[model samples]
Target: MSDVAALLSLARAAKARIATAESCTGGMLSAALTDVAGSSDVFDRGFVTYSNAAKQAMLGVSPETLARVGAVSEEVAREMAEGALARSEATLAVAVTGIAGPGGSEFKPEGRVCFGLARRGQPTQVETVEFGALGRAGVRQATVAHALRLLAEALG
Candidate 1:
């Protein structure tokens, strides 16, 4: 929670209004940010695009991209972040899509999360992280922490 508070402070200092686009973690990333006191000024909105339709309708993620790379890919994550910035009053947006589960295939394993960081007027960045078989809750929590780190690095 202290990390989250410090993150809010960093956003405050930079005047970076934040938005989130989430998938497997549900709204946990947004929940973490909003759980901190005084986050309303920094957090503009959150998009919980749990399904492909929601991703397309809410975040404007491309159907072609989803068809080619699937929902958990960096391509989708990038679109989600870019879409968040496009739809929100926020200056900074973060997106996460992943499989946090007790089951996964050989290609995309459990505890695999993709993240995107988009800052207005700058190139959006995307990355994939393998937390490696951590249970559902652990992976989700780790994803939130890593997303916060990405936000901090972007803020810096």
Candidate 2:
């Protein structure tokens, strides 16, 4: 089965609901989850916070955190996950923020993605990945796969 399908299966088995907060990947994560049959039972909602303002307004990612660490940082990802969990009726939440680009600075290179996962009663988890110049679509696809894996792991 696909990673998204596997995640949906696990979530359904556990009767857990999920939410997503996405930045560079846009709504691809949400689209992937909803692509599965009968995902509504397990998939709650999605926040497509593509901008710093949107992140703050939609997912409550603090402006201070954004200023301190930037949108692609682990801190913002964690807050996005936590905020999604708090705002939605979901039992679990996953977040992704990245610079999936053909352009990147010397410091934050292209294909550098940050992820966050949160379970209702558990500590929020954050991770950073360097996919290394995979281009925009490639990096986004990789991010979706990793995000699904994180959700599946949390379901376990």
The candidate maximizing lDDT is 1
lDDT of 2 by residue, 23-57 (tens): 99889999999998889999999999998999999
RMSD of each: 0.9, 0.8
lDDT accuracy of residue 50 in candidate 1: 98
Candidate 1 residue lDDT tens string, 1-156 = 498898899999998999999999899999999998789999999999999999999999999999999999999999999999999999999999999998889999999999999999999999999998999999999999999999988887
Would you give me the overall lDDT of model 2? 0.93
User: Clashing pairs in model 2?
Assistant: none
lDDT of 2 at 101: 98
> What TM-score would candidate 2 get against the native?
0.97
Once fitted onto the true fold, the runs of candidate 2 whose alpha carbons sit more than 4 angstroms away are none
TM-score of each: 0.98, 0.97
